[model samples]
Target: MHTFGSRRDIDGLRALAVIPVVLFHFGFSTFSGGFVGVDVFFVISGFLITGILFREINAQRFSFVDFWARRARRIIPALSVVLVAALALGWLLLTAKDFSELGRAVRYQALFISNILFMRQDGYFEPASDLKPLLHTWSLAVEEQYYIFFPLLMMLLMRHVRHWRWLLFAMLLVSFGLNIAYLERKPDLVFFSLPTRAWELLCGAMLAVLPASKQAVKPWLYQVAGVVGLVAVLVAVFTFDENTVFPGWAALLPVLGASALIWSGAQGSTWVAQVLGTRALVWIGLLSYSLYLWHWPVYVYANAISIDGIQHWEAAGWMLLALGLAWSSWRFVELPFREKRVLAGRKPVLVGGLLAMFALAVTGAVVRSADGFPQRLTGKALEYAQARDWRAGQMKCMLVTSDKNLDKACLVGANQGEPATQLFWGDSHAAALLPAIENNAARQGRPVWLYSMSACPPILSDEPRQRCKDFNQRTMEQIRRLQIKDVVLASNWSLYVYGREDGDRKVLLNPRDNAAEAEARMAAALKARVAAIRATGAQVWLFKEVPLQRKGTISRLTSLARVGRSAEGLGRPLQEHLARQGFLSALFASMSAADPGVHVIDPTPLMCAGQVCSIEVNGHSLYRDEDHLSDIGSARLSPLFAPVLLGTSDN
Candidate 1:
């Protein structure tokens, strides 16, 4: 049953997956598709594991104890070393909070449920993209979950059904259908869930049941199909990115490519298989287990320590170190633990030992994560957590606060489809000024409409953007047709200043001249905007450049924790972490140059001092993650908007 021709093309495909995944993580510009390597791995895992199960079941030699023991020999020894070493490294390099986070991830990694857990917690928009030590482990957890349930299901199918192949096929169809449907509607769920990923493994299971007799195939056809399949998987590895919805139809490229290569029957003589099964690829595949384990955490810790982004060459070095360590383990620990012929019954005993180690991991995660886990308490840290925007339902506000939520009642008020006492027009930059608007409107006792969208500046659509274009077009048409007054012109005007601006950035908006001309054009646009509204008997006030933040304060703060810095007595965490926020400094400098009189209200003084920006106010956080001003920060400065709106300063 195990004598089917070896497929070298599939190993070629594995090489394809690993290289791109490594490169993309290392910061290469192209090949966002490199992430699809994880999908390719999934397909390969399904095929191999299923082949083992089918061959054993067909020979009537399948045993749960034996199968699990084999998995222990294959996966556990190197994994234990990585986990134990990563835990120690985490404590050394990670700050208190970061260490605690690592502890929890280690715990989950032990339990094999980390993918679902991580998904239920953070999201893709988080600033710490490459900084997570256990980020790649999510894929490992997904594979382990399949390993846990799949073999049992196969065993049950073989025992219960006369037509077991039909049963496997039915299960495959169901799992695949669920995968496609879930990815489209609930992507985050699809990314983590066990059921959604089961089909990829089942595809391999299907291949195992197929006839392996050489009489069933032609050599040329096998070669051609194998090449196409391998190439398709490689193309996917080089082409996909984080934005690509995965495990749905998009995942079929890697999954089917793997299946075709297996079915293509590349014998030992086949160059693709020879290369795949070569000393290097299989050696990496052997270490792939270890390489996968060690690479991500070290990379994450490195990102946490460095203010500059994690570099690709740095990842390469770490990968080499991981490879070296994996080789040592393969020689010293793996062989002794698995080769019972040499080590006697020690291999089986080692299996129990590794299982016990996993149990210990579960225990540690549980202990550390508990509410009263001993020795981890700091009252001040608790206070800081409480003040974070999390409890106030502001998670949506930070992650994707863009103007997409116009349907929210807060966006539109007494003034819709017609004139009212006031109209609030602004971009997300203007949205920051909302607490100010709310207060100003209350003091004035005027009816008001809050029209704001995230990232979209309140400007006439000279051109279309994904969000700003439709929002601006609809708003301008509404205000004009409704003859609304009290229009406030504001935005992160730093993005596309009015005039022709020549800078390092070629502005995506209408082309402008030099930097000074850009400001003038922006001023002209503001003036024209005010004039257009005034033509309908309206008043306009422009909120000048809101103080831009330098770095993602929280992530950097976590980084600081990764170091040995006391979060205490740090003045303006943003200032402390500013290197990460140079993008904002550039924008703020551009906007400061404009000084546009669509009422240049400077809230900079409220958040900044001389050259520094603070992240704490009255013992509360002033910024949420990085760019967003916190409720405390926003509220503290809300009253500052009073003078501008009441005509006490500029209306």
Candidate 2:
């Protein structure tokens, strides 16, 4: 085997990459952009791996089997231990549905495709992502995938192609271009996929293959480069937040910074390098891989058991625990395999790694097939676990922007052929109310037309997607053609006005607009929409949004129940709900007062009382997720719509 002398500065750089990530995941506001650390790691990996591959291939000593075995030895053992530990903890703590999801995660992760699975599930910055024990593994999957194909590509280029460095550079540029191009349209895809993320690693690769200088380099130049690179990385770590469009142009900050640092250190040590090469930083850097692996699951499970969210002091304690676990994992698991003290033979390590992955995959499959062992819970816990299930026909009824066929809208209540006197129109929140509306309409002998779409409000506004604009127009035309007498406007109103708790502002009425501006726009748009429908001689029944529970609160319903803990206080404060909805409440009131034909329906009375907007009633959760009502929760709102459906006074 060939060896490159260890760079203590590089080890210190690893510490730089990991500390921010750990602090960020543990809810440290100071390390808001700590996620950029992953990008730094990518660059380091690309440089180091490419360095080894370039030298070996040039020497005609590169063996694919040997290279893969080394990689397996470095990665598999610690990873397997973490996976097993996560599954064990999940079984004890996770709800059946959550456990099932974890099982699915395990299956995909075993195949190094967890990034794909996560891309389809949740954005990395989403509040719910904190619950996923394996979420951090997406970065690992990206690295492993790069390892699988990159060495071969390097060999091909070295053996067959002249000017291989330029080819590698071109590939890097292409990947970066893809990342920037797709960031707006498919942010999640760009964030998780190897195609878009490859450039960061390739940046390091480019550094590796660059010709070494023959003459002595100036110390001043190295010092300047190192300082600038360190500053860039630190700036990104502090200034960037969840709202940043990542792995795009913004990603260049950390990626290039890390590359610069690596390049600077290649010649001779500078003051910046000396600072990085400190004993404490070097020790952390040595444990960086293990620390990264252990920290996320530790944070996830720690948050899972907490009644309220994890406090800062609690987070600090948990972080220390994660550090301890990481140290143990590095000491006992990572070092043994990496040093060839265990699974010493190449074939044994390779075969053993494959077998372990297969075994874990099979175990995941069994857990999934058995539905996460639902028999583990009983009574209220079981009920809460099942609460996430949407109403049976919701997917069919709630159209997406792409679904253009208005005729495909699900008809509900009375006979199918009956002329619908009432219409339910809005977004997914409206669809959640279908069960209540259908039951009430049936009792009142009134058929209702449903024209609901996901993320599309009932208001007429060009600010939303063009598809939404078209959907609203077609629905308006339908209301006119059918001579509908009543229209119910329902949506998660706060979502459009304030966006998600995780700083996702894209769903706002005008994502570019300020909060006050968005509120004003929403008010004007909603009023215009209501007046337009009223002008057509149809009464507008405006349903206010249900109380949105605190982030991760809904999932806690089942998790708390799983451990036989009372979920009595697991709800958002009524005052907090009122404060969030204050603008909408005032708007609805003004609209109703201005035009008696428009009636306001407030869910607060039904869903909240005594300064608390409870998520549960009689051991059953009212919410399916954070905001949307479950079927049972929706049925609870039957009385609110009963009078309108029956064409009687609400009193």
Candidate 3:
């Protein structure tokens, strides 16, 4: 039976794993690939935990009870405290929807299945994930889940297989192969699922089972291996970004690097080990587990409060705060529980851990059942909170991806028996203008058919989004069949021309085309679409895209109002909005000049007052969330629509 001594370098390695993650979460652009720290941690965990299991199994002293008890004591206490804290703070800060989501997260996290829950939601690195306080727990959940199955698998191998290392190597290859196979098709599953992640853990397990004497035979080899491993981890940290497809082939760098570092430090000391064993790195490493737990929640809360996003210096302050919390959690909660001072007996500690987890799960369920217990908010807080419900009751009119018949349910202006004279065709923006069209068309005694879909451009372009193509084709068929005369085209045009405001930085046309070429394609498509509409004897009315609110107007306004803060600078600048409109504006001008059937309707003049687009006009929010109009905002445009559709004045 072989027993391993504690390595200070391993603790320093923990520091290396955590610092980059903290820096990355804190929004430091320099550490874009700092997310690889989690991969490093995974390898370290596999090495240490496997080493313990291997040693115990060889000595014939391996106890599932004892192993689980140790895991419970190590993981449960600090986690419970963090959960309680998150519950308390979330109640105070989070909106009802956010709080409800938090409740769901809390339940999933308590069960140690948050990885599964998050898999169905946003990508880990997405901006939307920034606000989720419990997001980091997914990794802990993955590790704990591995611990549950790995020890049993290892014991079985020890009992039957004479060459157990070969089985481990084979399992590693299988898991790696599985990850590679589904890398592109199911990247999220590869990222969050245990099946694909098992290879990373097994990489460390392979190193642990190897003979220590064999590893220490050549001191120069350890030095070289350790240095190369350190460089590999650092390279992954510096070079990787959100665009990089991960954990298939890309994960090899950090996993192998961490394995090299662990193997080199097994017996003989390398130069990398000496550097890692320094007091500063070792101290940080000692607090690494607790630090990892605390940092993300701190960053999340900081982001939730700050409108523009947490500044670098403010993020530093939050990091310091996390450090203090980590130190306190480690010193008070973790150390005592680990040393058995809090729950002295193994059975007692195990019971206490189970009870605590159960209590947290119960609390989470209650929070969810109570619909986030919205009674915490009152008056203006409640008003702003409720403002987030910005759907504008138009879902029935918007043609979903699954919807087949365009004529069946998408009419907006009049009853089914009335022949539709006007057609509104575009994306969600066209749906947003439905209320005004309904009111105006009723006054004119003419039905207006609304056929719209979300994230679909109205243009007949060679863009790769087939859903848009299918919807537009069906809409054109309906227009020709009904002989619809007045056709209004509206869309969030910037998204197709310049990419999404929140997601992609710029538009991408084809794999081969540049931005200019893509713009040309968009312009040509618009012209062709206009000519086709004119051929059907329809006068095309193109509504200018609404000014986008950079800061989420309603949510931001609500958050600010809840704290008695003024939302003076919450709206997007008119100059920026106009600049984004430059290309579209020019295109519309050229189209109107060339075709007598085409008319441009500019909402910019009415929407923007002075140099700013007012998010709130006359105590009513002009925006529902960011870009889409609220019921009030849409109704306000009814007078504008009256003149165009009914050929009558507002009076």
Candidate 4:
């Protein structure tokens, strides 16, 4: 049903696509643009698949069933092996919450809707992506989805349209146009969806369907084309990064480059063909698909288990292991299915594939429904696993990005005819203190107003976050409108000063400056916010952020404890925390010293004892997911708020 003959150069192309992708995922800085490898793969797939369809359709021998069966045999066997291995390993290594999330991912992968699932969740480049073992499967989902519709669409065009090239070109233009249009506003959609990505494949299809010229071209021209194409791919692999607006016009570099190499190879002998036709390159290319399937999960689980995170050397070792796994999978799983050695008959192979897929889906559903099978954890691990639940009612209290209906409904304290005397303002960190504030206010017999927005710092700058500046302005007005006398300001201040896990960063004062300048700008913004609070006739109490736990605090601690091991030296050093917060701390102290109306309440001393901050204290977990305090942890801060709420000096 599908044959491209022996194109060793194409095999080399596969090597080109897989190596950089593996390198990039392994965290090699040199391969920053290595993610473009996916685009390269798309081009090669489009070319090869389109060529097969074209040949079969023209010969009047095309059968959708055979094509699909071939695809299933090629893809499913190794995929099933990897998925099963991941599930088994996940049962052992992942925390209950993470394992449950993995279950959801597995379900999506089985349904071949992982791309849509990922698009609806975080972007692929997000740091949390490292945790998802099935994250790489999104690309497979996209490719599968494309093949589902593409052959049918091509058949229709071939039957109806006199000139299919114009139709293909038109479709390409629409997809490319849509990609450009949605690049800024809907980047995730563009990145994950088939519509925006189809053009890259179409670029190869256009090449495949073009009439080959009989006239001989100069060898140097082919050489130049191959060189330029190779350079384009290399440049994109090195130059592009997580910050790049991808799959837009920027994708042209690798897409066109891949197209050029294919064209140059088809024309005759070129330097690229000579280079790509090497035995070693072709072998790696043969292993590329299996390699791609195995690499990400290997990296994900490896990183998950490492206490300090994977180093470059460790990553290299993992890469070697991935290569070994790829070879074994290719030799044992993929080849057996492809050659019909194991599932010999077509009906048997298809049935086996269907059953395998169904079993994986059922397993995934069970895992998800069972809440990642929490029974796997016991004693201390179970206690710590349950600690991740933050009972602060985040969606109700925190202002989401699209929130326009600003209702003062997030009131958290005493309510029996008592006016709201205390107000809390900041980001999600401020929201974490809700339990403590509610406890303290209930004891003091006072009502507290709680308002917060996630990832939006309480800085009064022209920060261009989604509704951040506007939200802060409205919050200030609300403070004055309510005539609140005591206002508490808190946030993950270091996050704003530094950046988030994803590459997205907050620009404090000046967008066109260094980190030191940004820190200065942030300090000034804090002072301005403080002045605004003072102007509202409110005593501003600056609540210092809690000590950050670096690894998955409670989860890591619990997982290790289950096996009679401890996550020692896992929490961030107290000195490192202090260093990150030094500027903010100084500003808070100076502001407090300058005005009687301003004060500072430090949570660090309470949370951290000497050298290290504790994830758990005396059998109770202090922190939740890496940095946020648990409900129990938040409750422990009740004493700090009591004096401030009672109109007594915290000092």
Please report, in order, the local distance difference test score of every candidate based on alpha carbons: 0.61, 0.89, 0.82, 0.84
Pairs that collide, model 2? none
Model 2: lDDT of residue 625: 87
Candidate 1 regions exceeding 4 Å error are 1-13, 95-99, 122-129, 214-216, 266-268, 340-554, 557-598, 602-624, 629-651
Where's the lowest-lDDT run of ten residues in candidate 1? 499-508
Lowest lDDT block of 10, candidate 4 = 500-509
lDDT digits (tens) for residues 123-242 of candidate 2 = 999988977999999999999999999988999999999998889999999999999999989999999999999999999888888886768779899889999999999999999999
Instruction: Estimate the TM-score of every prediction.
Output: 0.65, 0.85, 0.89, 0.84
Off by over 4 Å in 2: 1-3, 390-489, 494-540, 573-576, 609-612, 635-651
lDDT pick, better of 1 and 2: 2
| Candidate 4 residue runs with Cα over 4 Å from true position | 1-3, 391-428, 434-487, 493-539, 547-565, 572-583, 605-620, 635-651
Q: Model 4 reaches what TM-score against the true structure?
A: 0.84
Report the lDDT tens digits of candidate 3 across residue range 91-137.
Answer: 87777767788888999988989999998887786766865889999
TM-score head-to-head 1 vs 2, winner: 2
lDDT, candidate 3, residue 565?
62
Clash count of each predicted structure: 21, 0, 0, 0
Model 1, span 1-651: residue lDDT tens: 243445445555566667667666666767677777777778778777888888788789988777777776666666777777776665555444555666777778777777876787554324454445776778888888887788898888888888988888888889888888877567667777777777777787677676556664566776777778778877777676665767688888888887777666433234455556666675566555565666666666665554445567676676676567767877877787678543245456545756766775775575457522323424434444444443433333221344344443133222334335456666655555555565666666555566666656665545446555666666666677656555666566676653111122344355546656655555555555565666666555555555444333444444444354454333343444344324434543454455342344556677766555655654566665454555566667766666544644233
Q: Weakest 10 consecutive residues, lDDT, candidate 3?
A: 642-651
292-360: candidate 4 lDDT, tens digit per residue? 999999998777656567799899899999999999999999998898888777777778888888889
TM-score of 2: 0.85
Q: Against the true structure, candidate 3 has what lDDT?
A: 0.82
lDDT of 2 at 445: 78
